[model samples]
Target: MARVAFILLCHKDPDAILNQVTRLTAAGDYVAIHFDASAAPADYRKITSALADNPNAIFVTRRVRCGWGEWSLVEATLRTLQAAFDAFAQATHFYMLSGDCMPIKSAHYAHRFLDAHDKDFIESFDFFDTDWIKTGLREERLIYRHYFNERSQKRRFYAAFALQKRLNITRAVPTGIQVMIGSQWWCLRRSSVAAVLAFTRQRPDVIRFFRTTWIPDETFFQTLVRHLVPGREIESRTLTFLMFSDYGMPVSFYNDHADLLLGQDALFARKISAEAHRLKQVLGALYASDRTDFTISNEGRTLFSFLTARGRSGRRFAPRFWEAEASIGAGRSLLIILCKKWHVAKRLTAAIRQSTDIPAFDYLFHEDDTPLPDMGGIERSLAKRGRHHRAFVRMLYDHAGTDRVVICLDTSSLDLLGDFHADRADVRILEIDCDLGDDYLIGHAIRVGLAGPQTSRDTFARLLPTIRRDMIHERDAIRDARFKNAARLRETATDAENAAALAVFLGVDDTTALALAQTPHLFVD
Candidate 1:
């Protein structure tokens, strides 16, 4: 007879399971172990042979094949729980655990805690009413029939789901039960286990309903235990500490994570790395110690570290897919002049070139498909600006004698703007909120003879405000390299205003900026 009986479900790493069993039974707690049938037969033989003489350890008679996101895992758990429930008649509680789990507190403390509380420690909630399902299907998981394995046959699984959805086929929930969802770990009172087993015997239909349920192991015991135990007797929580990554995958604990695992508020920590031998040995020694369960503590330093780490991090600069010559971007600084009008960009390029020794290019990404500046000697097709956009741009830094180059861009190159302006380290954005109502485009088109001077300006000026607001929003919404680039942008309703803002952006004198702005016509062809 023991205070708590543990039902341990394990697939791989029989050595780890054996260690857990030996530790639990040594503290006078019963452990019923189940090895997944899909695993090597020799792993089962290994554990059974190791614990051949221990009376507190009993191997479950039934073995089942289990798969991820399938119903067989729940079957494995049910068999393991039944073996434990039948073996330890006088045990006060049954704790469900995985082989990856390690006790956070000494067995004596856990035993005493169960006796004091007398509550079932299980997480459960009404599935139809909660925001708990974060990544996958919530109602669709239950209502539809899944004939394909989601893990192994992703294409078939999706096809089946699509077919069911298209056909509008849905199954009803088993009668008289409110479906519940929770973490797949729990510790239940003896009476709770008895109630679950009784339900299994009386309601084979419900069991059948779950056999086709997706990830039933997460829902089965949680739903039943909620129905079986009274409200006051059920604690809506788990005794195990587990965490997931931002991508929803389980976060594995390593030897370096020993301190963090020890500091968790749970009585057990799970999904420990199988390769974490040092961590396992250190935690395994706790079974002999007299430590009780601890409160999460007032360690301001540790909490501070966690809060700081968990807080929103600075957004990363995504270099475009030109992977081969990415290193060239670091060779020199880049200033990209962005404007919605071709005339404005042309004017800015001419102004920057005349006022500063820095080389400037006129609309490098323009659709005209001209050769890149200083690359006129290369073959026309190879040197076309759009052929390898990012690579060709990055390579220009190597040819520039100075440390920086100014490249002007207009609406024709809007797609490149998204990728070009994103590099926070080496690239600075000079966005000209140039005059939207300027007739310079019409004037330039007439002078160039593209149209017969009868072409009217489109309604782009009416939409410029929203575009500007959206640009500011985009900058504010994304995290910077850590912060925004200094003095990188400006707005202007006239040439004088453009000069003032450009003076601040570039460290040029106000007089020089004014000259550059006023004398732009000197270089415009």
Candidate 2:
């Protein structure tokens, strides 16, 4: 039997299904683990203990924060591969998979299929404009890098000015930079593994450049393979669809997609439905020797659970709907201020640039304090100049057809949004506070790609306490005489009314608002 080493990078997923791991290990294969470094020591111990039971399994070095499009992940994967090669030199292939992934075919079938191909599968997609991925890659290299550099080096006045020219330079990255569409997960031969590391080591500068680039994972493998292996031997097709089920994000397979996953072509389905227990059961049976029970140590399943449950309690932007709405408004004139932290700001601005509507007002800087001096004088001279800065602000309001402003506040711009939102009730303010109860849910949902009824319940459990606590704080703040006077002036005639009004101000419901106004002393924890 030919041996394959499965290299899995996992984090915060003690509940990942180990049955699949068990099946692969039992199939005369080796398993090498690299759990996320941030995972608790206790959890790591549990993971090690569970894998230790399998003869082919052994825990390697600690993990790191493997951000998308970051160099850390490439470094981590390379280290893991070296360890795997050292631990099991005779293994025929080294397959890099995530905690959320699953093998679709039986172990025997998988081995046979690969043996026949004599090829390495990586999902490398072609870039034609208009496609989200293509546009995204372009912006990351050009526009985003400019704005990112500008914001970080605010003191370097000349550097900020230079960013404008750099942003428009088309085909900025090497034309030879061929992008392949494969699952970041790949099944590779020993030779390919050695080649990847050697190329990366040789081109340390390239690695350093990509370290700061966004979604480094997508490009890291593709760039290396394109540079190292001749394109002929490297199969661009990853043997999996790896599509997100709903909301246009990667997710677990639900009942509806089960047949699609089980169909003829693909060797593995990178994700499973977090909401669909049935899908899990089906996958469990495919890998299990007996019984229908599918619970195993796959972290993807657990992360899926955490996310879907969290998403239910929080706000979510359906990608398709977001795109459609933005599309309809695309041809229109609008003003969009990109006031997020450097990274988040770049993402939002890039999305805006991708939109169909060409914005009339595109402000990239974050702080209100640092208003462009050119704009500041115009604002002061607005009455005399008539069609100047005030006109610009008025034009923005007219374009939107509402007095309300939609501001996306990430980690950095929270304070500004908080103060601004409090003053402008007409503004439809959305605070994308990653710390909010529902925010946590959204994070989890995106990572694991699961959603449904049970997921909703989990969200409520996580969110309710947070809501209650926030309200409790609100109640106490309203008791001061000055607070009462201010409430009265704001048309909040009574304490209950004041609380209710405050709740509305805070974007909470009536019940939550009342709880905050009446029981400020109460702490949720």
Candidate 3:
């Protein structure tokens, strides 16, 4: 097996760091980590404890504060490489990664493939003439030296014009040299790392020169490799993983995007949020299982293992009617009338109205709808009383045409379902929020051993929303309703008050309640 060394730069979120380390160490690869001294000792100790038993792991020298766009990143990276080189001399290559970074490939494939090239894969793009290095740099340097860096304020004020001149000249200078940037996370041979350290040691002036420039991380290795061997040994292309970018933010992958990631044949991908359990399950089966040939972690786990996975499926996709045409079944042309309280409902209604096939929707409660007395004489002027109270009341009468599918807003529940009476068959109140909340709670209940799989899926669905809503909306009216146990309702009501029932008392969807029940672990404190 080709040995690999993983280097992680740790700062905050020690739990996340520990999980990454555990997964990497379990993969049978050597690991070296540099925790920025900027973090508290307790946090540092926590990560250290997690890696204590691993023979392939080492905690590097003391951490240092890394200023963004400065030499700190390169300094930290070099320190990690030096430590990895000394401790695991037999390792084939060193992979630089961040604490939140995840591996998209199987370890077996990564090890075999990396063993072949085992050369420098840094990607440098030329930008000497670009405004990023010219005008932008001059403007930023003045701001940084004079205002941001208090220690060098007086000295910078005198040299400010000179610095501006230098940046202008730099913009005109074309050093056909490209500043390599693939993934900051790279798979590099030991010789490449040794060369980086050796060159840095001999040329302290070069190191100091870059330390003064912005984005030292991008330039540090780029300058070294170019100055060291020119175009002889260093490969222009990088072997690291890739992720697509749109606009500015990264395009996150879903289970639907699985084929794209796998087909790309990259070593790793940028990031994977723990919230998507369905994607995790799909990816786990594909990449983290024995049936498949590729494996990234030796411990037989995938990137999903580190994140909280409970109730993930519920949030994956928006709820939608599967068969409006089929279900309508020759009835008085079914219309899904969107009610108020759900702002997104207006868009949905407009979309349905625009559709050629489906029954058109009647947008109610809009300015065109008949105004209520409290809604003021103005066209769409509903009185602005307490925000939550007015919202629920407006929701009660938002629908215009009675003969339609009066699906209530996200705030819709069985309790409020009785207010509207259209054609009994046509008036279906779709309790979307209630349904999702039930599913999330059920998932959590199962995970924490609060309920068995056989436990009624409808347990919370039928009982809680009504009971919870009543406690919130009509706390004083509890004396009227007939209940098997009034005291139990009161107690649950108190729990709701302290917990998420407050949202119910206010008029918004019970997001607080659903969030608490769905992510119980998060609400532990």
Q: Please provide TM-scores, in order, for all candidate models, with all chains considered together.
A: 0.59, 0.49, 0.47
**Residue 322, model 3, lDDT:** 28
lDDT of 2 by residue, 1-525 (tens): 456898877776676636556766776888877777766889888777787667687676656755444556767787788888888988988888777676666666676777887777775555333253623245445223322332334565336435645675433454445543335777788888888877767766566566655555666776667667777888876665475433556755667655445543566686665566677677666753432222222233343344454424242213232222222121222222222122333343344334323232223223243222244354334242222222434444555564433233332333332233233133332111112335544443434343323334444454446444543333332232121112210212444764554344434467654554444322111
**Among all candidates shown, the one with the greatest TM-score:** 1
- Residue 39: error of model 1 in Å? 0.9
Between prediction 1 and prediction 2, the one with superior TM-score is 1
Ranking by TM-score: 1, 2, 3
Q: Tell me model 3's lDDT, rounded to 2 decimals.
A: 0.49
Measured by lDDT, the strongest candidate is 1
Residue 403 CA displacement from its true place in model 3, Å:
63
What value does the lDDT take at residue 227 in candidate 2? Answer: 67
